[model samples]
Target: MSIANQIIKQFPDLLIKKDEPLSKYTYTKTGGQADIFIMPRTVSEAQAVVAFAASEAIALTILGNGSNLIVKDGGIRGIVMHLDLLHTIRREDTCIIAGSGAKLIEVSRFALSESLSGLEFACGIPGSIGGALYMNAGAYGGEISDVLNSATVLTRTGELLHLERDQLAAKYRHSTISEKDLIVLEAEFALTLTERQPIETKMAELTEARESKQPLEYPSCGSVFKRPPGHFAGKLIQDSGLQGKQIGGVQVSLKHAGFMVNVGGGTATDYLHLIEYVQQTVKEKFDVELETEVKIIGEDA
Candidate 1:
């Protein structure tokens, strides 16, 4: 029997898809396929899948909302796990507890509905709660680390753990999740009680700022490079005259140099080549290396 069949047989209740095209999931709308894709609805189901992958010596890839990620044309091997069905959001006193699959934007809106403050900056972030925490996602002047109270995570070995904010070691676009190969299941945020009017105003202002500056009309992985010390990635790219530069179907966003958009029919190969070209051009002109903030994974086609 094939591994996909084996997976279904092992977990009869779980939804499983074979040779699924991952482009349907990624925000950029560009990717190859997954050998076996599974979305576990319950925590126990997730743990079981992790255990199965480990015991069977099959590779496992954890994919969140895929807002800031790139999967190459060669696709991912073995099991690809997504947590979309686990999305749930609720308020607990002065805090909001959200499942990993919950979008940051939704969580922010939830906070607004409850008259809770502190998630205003995430009102426009496209990633899921887990993806936001993994990258310490930030916008304007706020970051996930600022309001995060705790998180429930599962190690690669399928051991569940609850961790405090300080234990996460979160920094600019980084956290211990990647280094430790941990998968976030849920996150809790401590918020302040505020008037609904102020929250609405803040969200509206931020929404306007983001919409005006970003290339939201096209498919793109938000923010290609990390901010270097004392310098902005967008400014550097813009100064390097990289705006609207095209390679294959992907092009450097004219609205924002930090983003590479799939104009139409863009592929993963196009995106990768454009990234390399931008890095090279920026390095040659400014003597600064543009390190990628977006997670690039899977194999080359």
Candidate 2:
């Protein structure tokens, strides 16, 4: 029997789908499909799936909230696991324990409700805790590395490990998780006790700033390019006169040059073309190399 068949037979209670359209799961609303998609509700179920894939030598992909990601037109092979059902948040005095699948926004709100101040910066980030940890996600002068105390992860070989902040080596939208190919199951963040009103005030200010600066109305993968050294990606793109540039249904957002928005029925190919065009244009004009912040995955069409 095939790996997919074996998975179904062994874990009949697990939700599994074949040839699932990945566009429905991504932020840009593009991509083809996944050979197998599994949604694991509990940590035990997630571990079992990981162990099965490891034993079978099948390719495994971990998907968080699908923000800051682009799936290719040809789709993903092997097993794609989504941990959306694992969303959970609990407070332990000054620290917050959040499941990998919990939305960062929700976690921030939970902190706010508990009079915690450290996570206010993440209130506007549109990703789950796991995804944020994977990329060391940051905004408005704050980053995940600032508060992350430790993470619980499962190795590719099915070994569960607890990694401290130093073990993560998170920096500038990069983390050791990708290099190690480990799956973050949960995270603990150290926070400070503060006045709820001030935390709420800061969150409000950040949310307003994001709303005013970002093209949130369109389907996009957030900022497409990372800040290049001393230069800002948006400023460089805007200076290069690439704003509002379009290829197929994808366009360099007029509202914010840093974003590549899906104007309509866009494809991953279109998104890639636009990215290349912008990169080439910016390099030719400013002589600075713009690196992508978005994580592109799966096979090409």
lDDT per residue for candidate 2 within 1-301, as digits (tens), equals 9777888998999999999999999999999899999999999899999998999899999999998999999999999999888899999999999999999999999999999989988999999999999999999999999999999999988888999988989889988887787899999999999889999999999999999999999999999999999999999999999999999999999999999999998999999999999999999999999999999999998
- At residue 73, candidate 1 shows an lDDT of 90
lDDT of 1 at 84: 86
Worst 10 residues of 1 by lDDT: 172-181
Off by over 4 Å in 1: none
RMSD of 2: 0.8
List RMSD in Å for every model shown. 0.7, 0.8
lDDT of each: 0.94, 0.94
How many residue pairs in model 2 have overlapping backbones? 0
